[model samples]
Target: MTAEATTRAAELKQAQAALQQGRFAEGLAMARALVQDDPGDGEALYLAAVAARYLKDYEAAEDWLSKLHRAMPEYGRAWQEAGHLALARGREAEALAAFVRATRFNPALEASWREQARLLAAAGRAAEAAMARRQQERLARLPRELVAVTNHLAEGRLLRAEEICRHYLRTHPRKDANHIEGMRLLAKVGIEFGVLEEAEFLLESAVAFAPDDVQLRLDYIDALRRRQNFAKAHEEAEKLYARDPASPVFRSRLAIESMAVGDYERGLELFDAVLQQHPRDPANLTSKGHALKTTGAREAAIAAYRAAIAAKPDHGDAWYALANLKTYRFGEDELAAMKEQAARPDLSFMDRVHIAFALGKAHEDREEYAASFAAYDEGNALKRAQTRYSADAMSAELARQKAVCTRDLFEARAGSGHDAPDPIFILGLPRAGSTLLEQILASHSQIDGTLELPDILALAHRLRGRRVGENRYPDVLRELTADQLAKFGRDFIENTRIHRAGAPFFIDKMPNNFRHIGLIHLILPNAKIIDARRDPMDCCFSGFKQLFAEGQEFTYGLREMGRYYADYVALMDHWDEVLPGKVLRVRHEDVLDDLEGQTRRMLDHVGLPFEEACLDFHRTSRAVRTASSEQVRQPLNRKGQGAWKPFEPWLGELKEALGDLAPREI
Candidate 1:
């Protein structure tokens, strides 16, 4: 560590020691000084709250905790302190609620769980008290160091959590319980960092060591799903369900896996069974809505969303789901209720983000352009602050790809890789026309539509290795033998088989796959690629207005989106120059103007016979999982072609970023 950082750490350690030794006054003074130096320091704020609470200054303690909670909602210690303050004020119910939230945010909080059990028992709630006691007992089995690691992980101190977890794993024996827990914690950190292959490997090794460990199996299944290894994930989910057929959690997980693998009927059946036992479950209701929406069951999806809202009025996800439908309009009462809930100080950070996006959509539908932009800006600002995205870094990575994947490299590795002619890749920016293209192609008799699979991205991450400062991926491609490239292609095809029906070809419409086009070429030499293009202004603004479920952090800002789009165009142009006649570029406006002609052109490019059904893509009934799901289910129109006009006043940054690439007219 640097000298300044070492000094700060020493001071924080001294303050912590003072608090531990009951020197509340001294600790409070020290913590206050630290907070004054940096108000955003979560650890310092937590120490101040702890010291004030011990000094019997409940108001000051709460003030500190409120700031901490606002800044870091996932900090379980803040919630625990709030619970203690509530109990001191003789508000047992409020204390119970706070403790429940504390434990929910961080299951390692054994004291919160014990207090929850005590409060439940005092309230004569025997069943809840027993459950809380069981939770506390289960947590008590974990080592104190592991519990601290969990606390740090929950509070977003990932580096510290990772350091402690790795130290534990290195020091402890393999078969020890603490070692197993350390593996799970480290795997969790990997998952959060988007290193799904590493997480899958860690959990797989841990599960092999203890095959009967249920939690380890569950974590493994989750890792599999994150890796887009849906077949393996389904197998693990089935095993878990067989072990306990009556478990709602297991059943729900199995149903989600089923839905992911395109077994919609079976998924809905399992979801219904779970709802029979817990009718007011907002999460299951939302999942059910997702399944219904993807399967083109519009009315049923709306009903499910409404039911979720009825169950929990502050369910911001349900509200956001409704707004995300694009076709759905919110009533005045619903809008008012969402605003009230959004304005509450006690709402969770994620919930507030959802409400802000939902309100933005609601206002946009009402043509309140200024209000819509404000809400969108607020939501994006909140989300952007939490992300670690850097536009310059992304640009640099793209530059590396351009530098590495040269014409000579392609010539040297030409004619290698698995001879898989059954894959079609539809890739581009997120708000581009990829989904519409997928829908059109899926209407063909020989094509199967799949979700945005992450196999290529995961492979890129794996090749990059665990370390940061090394550029191992595109450079590593040069060292791979022909057999290795073929094996990778074969593995990708085998892994994605679970999402495919009995079709001759399948579409992988992952937008981010555009970044790995060279990787795709090296792996699947015979695969077809379609570059889905849209008008730059419409595409960037549409992405700016929308809130994606994950990734696409660039869309949080207009300049970022525009610059990213410009880089994308530049890289794609380079690809065309190096890999000519390989990618078919389809324009969104041309497709809308001449649906049949464009459809026929696309089919011909893929070496398929022209089919009339491609023109009637809206009538095709299948799972559509994208922001444009509802829009694609309807006939083509120019309604969305110039959507950026209404918000043109605030799009100068986007236009300036696009430079010469910006559209001349709306």
Candidate 2:
């Protein structure tokens, strides 16, 4: 670490020790000084809140908590402090709500659970109190270190969690010949870190070490799913189902995995099997809706979503699912009901976020542009707070790609690595029309469509040595021998073969792969790449209004989204400069104007014949798993082309971020 960083760390440590020593005033001053020097320092903000709260400076404590929330909204300890502050001021009801929020953010917060139990009991809600006590008791059984690890994981302090979990595993080696919980916790950290292979291995070993441990098997299945190993996930889920034929969890897992593998009929059957036993299961109902939607059963999907909402009136996922259809128009009653649910302080954190996005779509559909923007902004704000994604860091990373992967490096490594041209990488920013391009290409008989495959990203992660975020990626590409590159390319093909049919060519539409063009070219030199480009405003605003299942944290804010788009464009330009004619640029607007022409261009680039089916792509029957599925199912139109115009009033930050790249009209 730098001298300045080392000093700051020591000061923060001293402040922490002061708090432990009951020197609240000294700790508060020290933390406030740190905060003044680095306003975004999450640790300093949290310590300041804790110290201020203990000192009974309620207003200052509130100020620190609010800043901490901006820095780390999902920080359980911060919310716990907020609960304490409210209680100190005799606001018992608010304290109860804050405690509930704390537990939701980090279930390992035993104090929050204890307080919740006491408050619920005082309110004479015996059943709720009993549930809280059970939760607290369950947490009490875990090792204190593990609880701390869980808290760090939940609060997105991933590196800290990984450090603690790894130490625990090292110190407790051979204690159980399995150490299931420690391994499982480490795997959870791996999943959070996007180190899926390590996570999958850990969970897989844990499951084998204790086959009857249902939680381990379920986590193993989740790791498999995250790796896009749908077939393997289904197999694991089936084992759980075998253990208990009547368990809803197993049935639902099997159903979801089955759908992932395109066994929609079997998936739907399994879903129905569970729903019949418990008709009001909102999660199952929502999953069924997703399955139906993927299979082009639009009306049936709508019904399933509506059923989920009816079963659980406050289920924001169900509400968002309906809005995500893009074509679904919300009715008056549905909007009011959603507003009521969103207004509830007792609502879950994610539920509130989901409802905000759903409300955005509802208002947008009604042409209430200002209200639409406000709701979308609300949801994005919540997400931005949670993720704490840094656009500057992202830009720096992409810049490293440009600096390391120069033309000379490509020339030196020319004619090496795998020679197979079987893969077609349709890559760019998310919401940049990559899905539509994939649909067009996959309509051809020779091309197979796949989900946004994680194989490339996983391979990149594998190359990033032990220490991540130290700029080891594209630089490491220089050290990889030709044989190593070829082997990696071969492994990629073999591992991803599960997602492919008999087609000779397949699409891997992972948008983030644009940052790794150098890595892709080094491994699979003959692979074809298609750059899906869209107008900045349309793309950024579309992304802002949508709620993705995971990742794409940049889309949570207009400025972040715009900056990311600019970085993507710069990176793509670098790729073009270094590897001319390697990537085919297909603009979304160009496609809308001349679908057949652009389709022919992409086909020609990939050495495929211009089939008429590519023109009738919307009519082609295939499972599309993207936000654009509904839009892509029908004919291409200008309906979505200028969507940002209505919300232009609130998009100044986006335009400012885009600068010269922002279109004149926008």
- The numbered model that scores best in TM-score is 1
lDDT of 1 by residue, 1-666 (tens): 899888888989999999999999999999999889889888899999999989999999989988898777767878888899899889999999999999888888999999999999999999999999998997799888898899888878788888888898888898786788799999998888777777888999999888898889999998998777887898999999999988999999999999888889999999999999999999999999999998999999999999999998888889999999999999999999999988776678888888899999999889999998889888888888888889999999998889999999999998999998999999999878899999999999999998899989988988997753445987898999999999999999988887888899999999988889999999999999999999999999989888888889999998999999999999999889889988999999999888888888889888899888988899998889899999999998887878888988988999999999986764
Question: How many steric overlaps are in each model, in order?
Answer: 0, 0
lDDT of 2 at 23: 100
Query: Which pairs clash (backbone N, Cα, C closer than 3 Å) in model 1?
Result: none
**TM-score per candidate, chains pooled:** 0.95, 0.84
Q: What CA RMSD would candidate 1 show?
A: 2.2
Model 2, stretches more than 4 Å misplaced?
A: 1-141, 155-160, 176-178, 468-471
> Across residues 59-129, which tens digit of lDDT does each residue of candidate 2 receive?
99998888887656667888888898998999989999899989988999999999999999999999999
Q: What C-alpha lDDT, on a 0 to 100 scale, does residue 494 get in candidate 2?
A: 89
